[model samples]
Target: MSDLAILKRRHALLGEKAPLFYEEPVHIVRGEGVWLYGPNDEKYLDGYNNVPTVGHCHPHVVDALAKQAGKLNVHTRYLNEEILNYGERLTATMDDSLSRAFFVCTGSEANELAIRIARCATGGMGIIGSDATYHGNTSTVMELATNRKMGGPKRKKSNVRSVPFPQMYRAPKGMSEGALAQAYAAEIQAAIDDFEKRGIKFAGMLVCPIFANEGLPDVPLGYFELMQQIVHGAGGVIIFDEVQSGFGRTGSMWGYENTGIVPDIVTMGKPMGNGHPLAGVVCRPELGDAFHAESTYFNTFGGNPVSCAVGNAVLDVLEQEQLVEQAAEVSAYLRSGLDLLKNDFDLIGDIRNNGMFFAVELVKNRKKKKASKKKPLRIVNMMKEKGVLISSIGADRNILKIRPPLPFTTDHADIVLEKLTECLIEVEG
Candidate 1:
């Protein structure tokens, strides 16, 4: 058999009954600043992945990981200065109320831990989330992340409800932005009412400041404030899942900072260790106290010394390089480029962005518009063929998710725009 055929057969055997997102996937062998290289050493511009917040294999992060591993890679049981120092640095960037930190290895675990803390702090069973907002893959968070239809089975007794995402692209007609914000906030209030009707108290609301996986739905201004009031009045905590949008990816220290609301608990990851396995949940001291009193939560490798050291180094690099500011500046440039492209291409329906995080929605028809999932899949694959890497997302997988590392530059933006323009033209034709 041919090499390709053998590889395909092996894949089928490994996933005997599993469903895959793509029929054919590229074999990436290495990555660096804003680029991924295939097994054949072909360079692909990375316009989608954000887990490498700073850049793939950043020198500072690599060095820190190596140094810590050589010195001591112990767990939380042993008192370590690296964990303490990293926690202090991370919490310093958060709101004053969020003065405590609990480390985890991935965004999913961080969010799971955050939900546990929220439930304990409020002593409530009901939880709420925005429609199409992805928190994590764990059972509790999966229950809260009900935007996607494929997100597992519904929780029969888990008092989790979903509110409509505050998407300006599909907002109600004739509604002002402020009015739309209020309307979206009302959805949460309605959820609270439903909870009360069911004799269930409100636990908390989980939100993604930019709604990463659902589409880069920028939360309308004042929306966070209104929702905060509603959740707080209903005796529920607020959790911001900044997993994909944190660590300067949104051009700020944190995504919630752009929303101008201070959440009771904020879970962050992906970029915490610049591609290293590290994540954390920072919460209000009161919530942390409640969580501690409720249960002794610990992970074997959550706050290991190596992860802490790498995380600390990531923070240093972010500050010294001013990558957050770079994201802000380059985001404006990239958005403008996308806007110009939208004018040239009718299929490009919406351009939504926050900092370096952005998405371009591909639509089938401008008039009875609907997401063109097939078109995006084709475009993503075509772009990959053209030496650019991007991904498709949204409820229908029609939105092109454009999130690169903070180190992405104007030159990189130009390359992405050029390749995307070509892909759109070919697809449109």
Candidate 2:
């Protein structure tokens, strides 16, 4: 079908507001390692998808899925050795405290279950999230997505509160990094105090360790440490939403590994099953026990045999290929290339990256750092036309988000940098 025809049908069925990339959406028909193919077989370098963590249709992952499905695919209610094996292997990569696992089908479901566990274990109702971040789309989790900065109408939920995520690029003038960290951490304490004032017991603070959605900002030094002190002091747990930053995306097994503090719970998904619907929450044993004891929770297909097989295959690829180390090396090379671009392009304000994930903020004036909201979309569309796929993030929608599959190499980085430079020139003109 034609792009216009598909678009028309998409709008009719999925509603006009369903999101699509670029001004002219490409009709993708298939995918392979680090690339997507149009219906006509024109290939575009994939640089914005994290779901296919290992790579698109990796033979190993595909084989595992096929083999498992051919043998058996059933819900989690029955005895499933795949779940037990995968769970043991997965948690062994984390801090010893986070030893228990709860299976779920999506990042949203993982986060929802994490929150439920926090509330149950802590005996509190209040939840905290970043002012300009997203966790998921479920009703309760949607509360975290409703903060004013996201441009959505605020949901009036008394039990939820949001604090400014710390970022050095936009810190108040003349404030030291230490002060900035303190100021940001103070916001969490303020929220906790507010919950107490309003007679709401504090549950926990949940946020992305690297603040990926907040433009992948360079968090002020010592922020996580102060945040740990404040949250734990208030008798609240810490939940790190590693949905995007986990599975070696951060050059580490987990995003929290880069941070100084350890979280009480971690929710992960996206890349877990390498495009399969597998996601989960890992937490302290006490919290897991309390949650299960008080509230019954079971997802019918969360930890199915097929999903676990896919998850295992993804892990196998990560280990056998050493993609985590590659993410570090390639991302460093790519960031250096972007640094060179920043030196030439006055529109480039700041560039931040976490391993394979990158955010390049565009500005109308470098001195003022005024976000150039319109230019990013233009650049993204232009890059799309150039046979490269990229996207934008941040509250202003002015930061380019380039996160590709794990197999992306320096060659792929060169293509991204070359296309980006051309787009910047044309957009600047």
Candidate 3:
């Protein structure tokens, strides 16, 4: 079918608001390694998807998934050794305190479970999230979604509070990094205090440790440490939503490892099963026990045998191929290349990265640090025209988000860099 016909059918069946990439979306039919193929055999370098973290259609993950599906596929209630073994191996990568796991089919469900655990353990309804961030789509978790684009609650829920995410690029003039960290941490404390004043008990703060949705900002130093103390002192848990920053995307196994603070509960998604629907929450034993005691939680397809096999296989690929270390090395190379581009392009404002994930902020005026909202989307579409795929993020949607599969190498980075340089020149002209 033609693109227009497909689009018409999509709009009619799935509603007009369903999101698609670029002004003209690609009709991707096949994906392998770091590339996606269209119907005419035209291939585009995949540079924006973390869902296939180990690379799309990796033989290892696909084989494991197929083999397990052929043998058995059952929910968590069944006696399943695959689930137990996978769970044990997965949590072993985390801090000792985070030794328990709860499986779910999507990030939304994982985050919902994390919120439930926090509220159950702390006896509170108050939760804190970043002012420009998205956690999930579930009605309960959507209350924490303050991103206007996500269509969160029209009115701010009294139980939910948002704090300005810390970003060094836009720090108030003359404020030291140390002071900025304290000021950001104070925002959390203020939220907690307000919750108390409003007679709402404090539950916890949930955010991506790397602040991926907040333009991957260079966070202020000592911010999370102070936030940790403030939250714990207020008798609340710390929940790190690692849906975008987990499974070696951040060089470390978990996003929380990069931050000084150790989250009480960590939620992971997307990359866990390498395109399979697998996501879960890892928390302290006490929190898991408390949540389970209070409510019986069960998911039909979460941690099914096939999902566990795929999850285990993804870990196998990560370890055998050493993708985590490769991410660190390739990201360093990409960072240096991006620095060279920054010198050549006046549109470049700030570049921030965590391992393989990168965000390049565009600016109309570097001196004033004005966000170039239109240029980012235009550049993204232009890069798509050049056989490369990327996207835009941030509250103003002026930050280029370049996050590809784990198999993406220095060579792939070079292609992205080359295409990006050309696009910037055209956009500037």
Candidate 4:
């Protein structure tokens, strides 16, 4: 079928919810390593997909899945070494206190369970999330998707309070980093007070350490640590949503690893099974145990043998290839190239990132540092036209999100850099 016909059928079947990227969406037929291919085998560099963390259709991962599915594909009901071993391996990456694992099929399920655990443990009804964060699609989790309610008229969740993320890039005229940190934490403290006053107990804060959708804003130093302190002080747990930044994206095993605060619970997905439908939550043993004892929570396909095998393979590839280190090295190279572009093009406002999780905030005026509101979509569409793939995020939709596969190299970074520059030039001119 033709592309337009497929699109029409898609809209007819999937309705307006069908999201296809690019002005002229490419019919992606295949992917390998860090490149996507069209029906005619036209290559497009992938700089916007982190789901294929180890790279698309990695043979190592594919083999693990195929082997496990053939031998044993049972659910967690029966005795299974694969799921047990995978859980053990996964928890080993976290702190000793947070050594328990609860497997679920998607990030939303993990988050939903995590919040349930938080509320049960603390006997609280209030949740705190960053102003522009997207947690998940489930009803409870979507209540925490504050990104949708920030700039528009929408029904507010009284129990869920939103706090401003510490964005140092567009800080008030002379605000120092320390001041920025204090101000954001203070907002949380005030919210906690308000919750107490209204007789609503504070369960916890759902945080994405990188603050990805808040434009991957350069979070102020010591801000997260301070927020952790306040949340625990208020008798609430800190749940880090690592769905987008986990599994070797941020040059580490977890995005929260470098943030200095040890999260009480870490909700993860997207890259867990490396394109497979797999996700889960890691949390404190006591919290998980308490929730398990009180509630009858069972997912039929949560920790199945096949998913565990795939999960194990993804982790193995991450370690054997040293993708974390690769992410670190290539991220630096990519940043350096972007820094050079920032020098060449005044449209580049700021480059905010650590490791492969990057955001290039475009600006129309260099002096004013205003967001080039409509340019990112146009630039990404043009980049798609030029045989490269990328996307945007944040409230204004002006910040370019450039997270590629973990196996991306310096060579790939150069290509993205060149294409990004050319796209910016074309868009600006």
- Cα lDDT listed for each candidate: 0.86, 0.92, 0.93, 0.88
lDDT of 3 by residue, 1-429 (tens): 999999999999999889988999889999999999999999999999999999999999999998999999988886869988999999999999999999999999999999999999999999999988888899888987776667666534468899999989999999999999999999999999898988899999999999998889999999999989999999999999999999999998888888987899999999998889999999999999999889999999999999999999999999999999999999999999999999999999999899999999999999999999799999999999999999999989999999999898999999999999999999888
Task: Give per-residue lDDT, candidate 1, residue 376.
Answer: 91
Clashing pairs in 1: 132-147
Which ten contiguous residues of candidate 3 have the minimum total lDDT? 148-157
**Residue 255 lDDT in model 3?**
86
Measured by TM-score, the strongest candidate is: 3
Question: All candidates: CA RMSD in angstroms?
Answer: 1.9, 1.3, 0.9, 1.6
Window of ten residues with lowest summed lDDT in model 4: 148-157
Residue-level lDDT of model 1, residues 301-392, one tens digit each, is: 99899999999999998999999999999999999999999899989888889899888988987665688868899988888888777888
Residue-wise C-alpha lDDT for candidate 2, range 252-313, written one tens digit per residue: 99999999999999999999999999999999999999998899998999889999999899
**Alpha carbon RMSD to native, model 2:** 1.3
Candidate 3, residue 409: Cα displacement in angstroms equals 0.9
Q: Please give the distance, in angstroms, between residue 176's alpha carbon in candidate 1 and its true position after superposition.
A: 1.3
**Cα deviation of 362, candidate 1, in Å:** 1.2
Order the candidates by lDDT, highest first.
3, 2, 4, 1
Clashing pairs in 3: none
Candidate 3: residue 301 Cα off by (Å) = 0.6
Write the residue-wise lDDT of candidate 4 on 1-429 in tens digits.
889998999889999567788777789899999999998889999998999999999999999999999998877888769988999999888888888888889988988999999998888989988878788778888876655443322424477888887788888888888988999899999989988888799999998878887789888898988998999999999999999889989999999988998999999999999989999989998998878878967888888999999999999999999999999899999988888888888888999897898899999898899889888888888888888888999888989989999999999988898888888788768
Error of 4 at 303 (Å): 0.9
